[model samples]
Target chain A: MNKPKHKKLTCLGIESTAHTFGSSLVSLDEENQGTIISDSRSVYQPPPGSGIHPREAYQHHSDVCSGVLIESLRKAKMDMDSVDVIAYAGGPGLGPCLRVGAVVARSLAAYYHKPIIAANHAIGHIELACMLTRATNPIVLLVSGGHTAILAFSNGRWRFFGETLDITIGQLLDQFGRAAGYASPSGAIIERCASKSEEYLLLPYTLKGNDPSFSGMLTSAKRLLSSGKNMDDICFSIQETAFSNLCEVTERALAFTEHDEVLLTGGVAANTRLQEMLTEMCRSRGSTFRVIPRQFSGDCGAQIAWVGLLSYLHGMRLDISKSIVRQSWRLDQVDILWRH
Target chain B: METLIRKGAEADIYKVRWNGLLAIKKIRLPKGYRQPSLDAELRKRRTIHEATLISAAKLAGVNSPLLYYLDKSNYSIYMEHFDGPRIKDVLDDPDLGTTKIFEAVGRSIGSLHREDIIHGDLTTSNFILISDGCLGIIDFGLSFRSNRLEDKAVDLHLVKQTLESAHSAVADEMFTDLIDGYRSISGDESTNRIKSVMRQVQRRGRYARSV
Candidate 1:
């Protein structure tokens, strides 16, 4: 749909798909360019040596939802009346976590009499990165705790060319880190440890066609750690093998689509080593590579707010009763109404 | 004389002269991104594996490029080149009677499955429509011997995904014809089993819960 002349809209988005409860405000001006007004989030830290418990994560989101929302609006120096739409991450995540965000958004919409939008978490990541990086069409390598897929837009939807057949890259790092007595979500620490060693251990590099399976590699890494292998060397080898598998699949997608740009998004996009490797690969093949800024690379409310604004502008208005969380929603199943 | 033709993710294809014949040479290039030892091992293994699968595919009565030579040390393979359009480029052409072509594809895949061969990559791009109007399969780099029903289902699922994603305009008609052709060779019982398994495979994707 063509934008009405000089039309402007503001959206407030909530994200509680996992451990983080985030809120942000985005404003779209007459030019259809979106500006993030404010972004605030509170992340729940699980007990040491344990993964996130879904119930505890839900409680964390419920406790922090209002505070994060208020902080978002306060930082923007705007109130709820200024927001033209309310949006929340609706699916493809933990059901309990998603419910908290959806409930909050629904409650706000009811109180304020504002229209609501149910945004797909994965699409939020992609659209926000695309807007920030100015990539119109590109092969997307979405890597995170819950996802690892090489995708491209075709036939009005994101189509997966390849993905992890088992555990994701993020899970691989987190589980390995936990095996070494670190808490979950230990990608940063793993990266730090990996950088200190140059040794490479040969682990199973499983690539069934374009799809990569990391479960076997994770088991092997744990075995190495138990057998008294140096943690740093194992970390180094895991990163080397896993990142290479990712890049190889991405390269294959690039060859098939011949897209001039490649966009890296999601939580694991924060890894500098991955960014470097992807950049080098793209350079060798004459394609532009862009990573979402480090701060915005991970789960954030800004992505939800930005995509929410797009959905609003495209005339998507979900009734509060009909607006519910879909825990099993897939990215490719979402329609791209805002994009051609 | 040799001239480069296509640079694939795992290998580079070249149009070359082999013993006064027009042939193709596929060389698995060393990836700079992977560790040197890992890269060397992967390239060598895939080069040999592709050669083996290609010969096996022909023995199973599948139409594939004829092998001329295998250069193990160089991670290269020399084979007869059949110049034609990729099936991806022409599957939807209304004038081509595309249903029969898709049926042929299914028949070929059914035969491969019967021989316990799983073509890990089954995209339309890997199929070539040769001069004699016969369907030719290429790229056996990911092919493997598998008797598992899951493996066979995955092969079928990949073809469905490719058609839906890259050739949506005529996917419905094409897929129906493909299943019919496949059933003619595989019989109704195994086809039904494979179809059910393929449904499970589709649902097993991340965030794709079974309903």
Candidate 2:
């Protein structure tokens, strides 16, 4: 979608959500035409049972920040000065990790005299996924290490219909996997094991009204494992319960929002079972199901860069002196406080 | 004329009138140990970062004070002046006896955490009971987006610690209410994360005590 007579705006985006430290340079022209010129990512996977420390993640950011920036720019075939804006994940992240990204972004903004845009990491992922598949007004099921919510895009904002009550789907997967002596952040491994296990063990499934109780299920699974149950069966059972709960929530949210399309985003969106279940749910309802490619599904900077460009197009320029790193910033909080 | 409202380790807050509207100014102090140039750069960056975060949270439908201005060169943030009692103040006063207040605070915190933004220091003091009775989170200078269980757990731990330290008499009750409220917004996964992290926090606490 290349066009002439439109001023091309280039953006450099940085993402530091969880274990991934990512940077991407995207170029958007007039009429919102965009292209991802370069993207680089670094992941820090700690050993099993050893959780990700905020300070350690921050250090990881510090170690990879320069390289990621340099590589993204090189891939984009542009220099730092050519970047029209700098965007970074603002909050719903680790404090130290967010600080590192913010510091780098601010420094770059200062050095280049470019406006800085801060985006909510989750919203960034959602928008990018939606844009990738051209999906609109879909039922969104976001499941990651930190979040599990059924959302719908309406009234110019995402309306949340249902979500987990205790632990995030990804977190539950990781914790259960770790307890079962798997690697750290055991989403992929658990998915693999669950695929192999044939028997389904009965676990606690507490559906409280519209909300699903994951903590109860996790506790039940842990107890079952501790009481000499099959680890493989428990893993498979937990995945099934979590995915089933998510699917039920998504169906309810879809019915409540009265939307047909379902778009899934987040790290755990990569699970084949979740994808299969969601696809089936959508198919049964004659609705559409969309999942962005795995790279974009997880944390990345392209969406941040794109959203930053949208803000710029809307004339929301940052007062260079007024930019700061926020560890807990949210997307809805933007309109209340920020004025152009 | 401006009045000094409050002071913390990192900032001195001032109540000022802007165009006949009330505003709060958070000014960062220069660090002594850091080189002058580095400190100035650091202060300017931090001031902007905090202001940006406040604006971001406001956009996400989270209750936070509006950011009026950021004087990054001077390391100061002027935000919509909120006139309300801090949640901590409300919780500490036995006469208030607002049992439902804890639930409200918990929901607000839970909503924030659900959005993946953890208030690094989730003390009751960080929230203001607005005139509308809605709890507004303040001081996003230490906020961040994280999907890690440990990070989220630490945020809850901070809140738990705050309750134990400042609201001990009703700490257990308040914590339960908060979790209940948090569950209402965050759903079951958040509760599970909290339970897991809380267990870890307790274990760590025990280890610390033994050491």
Candidate 3:
């Protein structure tokens, strides 16, 4: 299949999927190659042990949106009139945060007389990873603070083969870390501490026939941490079990899809051990494994902007009047038959 | 020419182009929750207050965006724009692996607070990693001029909280570098205030949890 000739389109993307409120600008050329001129992100750190509040997150977004958006455009050396489309993560996030993004997206589209492209934040992440690494027909393992899913893309659509049955991988890490007297979003700290220790304790590994249960494992890890076990040991066990479960599900997805490529995305993918394990598993299976660099792994607006350019080139546009933020919009809900 | 970008709970930011250079226009957005006439009066006063603070920081040899324009009628102020990554992203990178960056962050923040500027939001996002490797603090929206030790301590406390919550793996090393830099710039007395503030914040956090 010949690659489609890409035209130059400038897209502004807004991302507020979890705790980060980010904006970026992407300019795609005729070869479908792109340059991310500017990207700025503002993260809202909730008080320790507090779940992310929607209203507060929204207020944070509103607080920083102007500076972030302007910085992105200034870096791109473009004006609002020069922007071709406005893209935003539309769902599966805090409702108030999503509303802030949606309101800005709709407002920008209306003001610029441009099209709005409401993107599936998760899919946008995977697509950006694919574009960056040039991976094809891969089993995508998306593990972030809020989501954990195994997706297979083929025949022009992505299919969800398996996912977390309860809490996401990052959430598990955070919960266990907090229980251990650490702060929230503790994946990196746990990984760092685990790297220091050598002994591995047995943590619960819940692989209940293709579906993974992280809450149970989290509880088990919490119990071990509270039981006066070594903190490093608990961290190691949890990391090992989580990575193993992910590898198991990923391997199953590859077998089911018969795909030779596996790509890892999301914040947890930044963990060196997880990447190495996934890579080793794929190598053992005689399959290819790819991961985007750490900078591109998390929820960043650059990914959204890049995908937004692609959608614009493909003539996928949203009606500004009807476009609204959806907190639970699924990736598969949109029909791509027209493109084919 | 200044262009509107967005309005927040406390301020507004704009994209301004001046003499072939891009800049940011910030204004204190009005808060209606306060007494109506008082809100308007406060908004007007804050625009001047923030602009004066930015200028003062610039005069103090700090690497802040340059102030170019101000219009109190609309609560608007313009300053030079920076085109660079945020310090948060720089620290987030596993490859960069440099402690100096954090030191620079700490020193810049220290200088600001020492000069009586309390950055209400001290998250890594509020600063930028300019091309020259220097750090520039942006978004004075939540910032105010204060000489109180509690405010300076709160600033340090917020930075610590941010590191622990967002960048936990390197939180200890990064925050240490920050303190070292802050101490060198802000003097021993200021550092003591920061330490005391840190204790107070932690105790408060613990007390709130227990309650």
Candidate 4:
């Protein structure tokens, strides 16, 4: 395949999809491949034992928007004028949070006369991993608070082969953590607790075809907790059961598609246990397994910036008048024109 | 003598000579991703459930493969082997593809649904084009008995989803013909009801509807 040639370009990416407000600077080389020059972020912490309030996260993003952007500019040693395009996560996120980022990107694009791009939050996660891992045409398993889907690129778009029927894997972990008196975004802590136990209390394994439902498993885990079951065991059981469900559906997609590679990304991709399960599945099938680095697995500006670069090269431009936020945009709806 | 034919998601299917007759033996393979106990239970339950579903589908007038034998101890099912191409492989081929086959596919599924049988996995990969040019359903690992309109719709949605995902070029034409065939058996009223319910079922999917 011939590589598309393009002049060097720089893009500033803004991400305020959920709890974290991030800004990043990315520039393309002569080969048209993107490189992240700088990424700066400020995450909001909700009160312990409670989940994020969209209004509060929006406020948090509003407060730190300029600071994050300025830090990214400073780290990259370039000012906003140096950026040829401005990109923001447009949808599949908190409405208020998405608005904050859109506002920032719109203002920047209008002031600097730069092209604005609306990037899908989920696609950002997938593209960043693909760029970093050099995985072409692989089955992607995206697991995060906002999404849990097994996807593959087909017919100019990413198609979902499997997904969660109810709550996402990330929400299941975080909700479980909150019930244990911990704050939201408790995946790391849950992993720690889960690793400390070997007892596997059987939970409801709900696999409806390629779709896995976690609400039942979540309910079962909560019931076990209230019934005085060991917290460690409960956490262990939840992780084992939930991750196994994800792996099973993903494996089915793999076998069905006959893809030779698998890419694991999104916030929940940081979990070592889930990673190990995916790795094992891929190994047994003789397929290559790629996981995004922990630092880049979650929501980040670089993801948007990279996708923005790709989109921009493919002539994607959102006029300032049309720069709007979409809270429920789906990943599959995005046309991947940049890819062959 | 047995020869491995396909390694499916939950099972390994082998072509075997059972009593000097051609047959297919499906063995549910243990998934390393799952706990040993959980894996064992799921494999056992699905093996028996598949056999039961196949028998039910046959009784419902659907042309599924005939069951030859079932072994619960090792989670295997031996059934009649059809030396035909999977519908998925020939659905879009000019010489092999035909709207008549998809219509037949829809009718078979309509019959199953009329009997309150849901073929939980309804992708074209499970449909075989036998020598006589009939669509024979196979691999009922996920099938179950459900009278709910929602369950039936979901089963159809899976087929639609697969067609769009894997056979985008001919998906729309195939789906229309398939639905037409479905309407012939299920009637326009029930088909319309199911289609509406199928829309709801489709919307219930994560990020399904654009807001």
lDDT (CA) for every model shown?
Answer: 0.88, 0.72, 0.74, 0.88
What is candidate 3's CAPRI-style docking category based on DockQ? incorrect
RMSD after Cα superposition, model 4: 1.4
lDDT of 4: 0.88
Model 1 per-residue lDDT tens digits across residues B22-121: 9999998777778998998888878777899998999899998899999977899999897887787776565544447888888889989999999888
Model 2 DockQ, alpha carbons vs. true complex? 0.01
Model 1 regions more than 4 Å off: A1-6, B92-97
Which candidate has the top score in DockQ? 4
In candidate 1, clashing pairs total: 0
For each candidate, what's the DockQ? 0.63, 0.01, 0.01, 0.66
Query: Interface RMSDs of all predictions?
Result: 1.4, 23.5, 23.4, 1.4
Q: lDDT score of model 3?
A: 0.74
Q: List model 1 lDDT by residue over A1-340, tens digit each.
A: 2565656889999999998999999988999887888999999988767888999999999898889999999999999889999989998789999999998999899999999999999999999999888888889999999999888888888878887877899999988888898987999999999999999999999987767899999999999999999999999999999999999989988877667789999999999999988998888788899988888888889899988888888767787889989889999888888776
Q: Tens digit of lDDT per residue, candidate 3, span A217-265? A: 8888888777788888778778877887788678756654457899999
Worst ten in a row by lDDT for model 1 chain A: A1-10
Candidate 3 C-alpha lDDT tens digits along B1-211: 6666643324656787766778887776543222234446546755766677777777556787777888767787878888777777777786654557878888888878767887655667667888656778876544677888766776676667556544656779888888888888988886977797667654442112221
Task: Show how many residue pairs clash in every candidate, following the order shown.
Answer: 0, 48, 2, 0
> Model 2, range A1-340, lDDT digits (tens) per residue?
2223448898888888678788998887666666788888888777767778888888888999899888888877889878888988877678888878788899988877888988777777777777678776677788788677666543345534444656778778888887888776898888888787968775665543244668888888889989998777777788776776677667655653456888999889888888887787677667899998887777777877867766665667667566656655444334311111
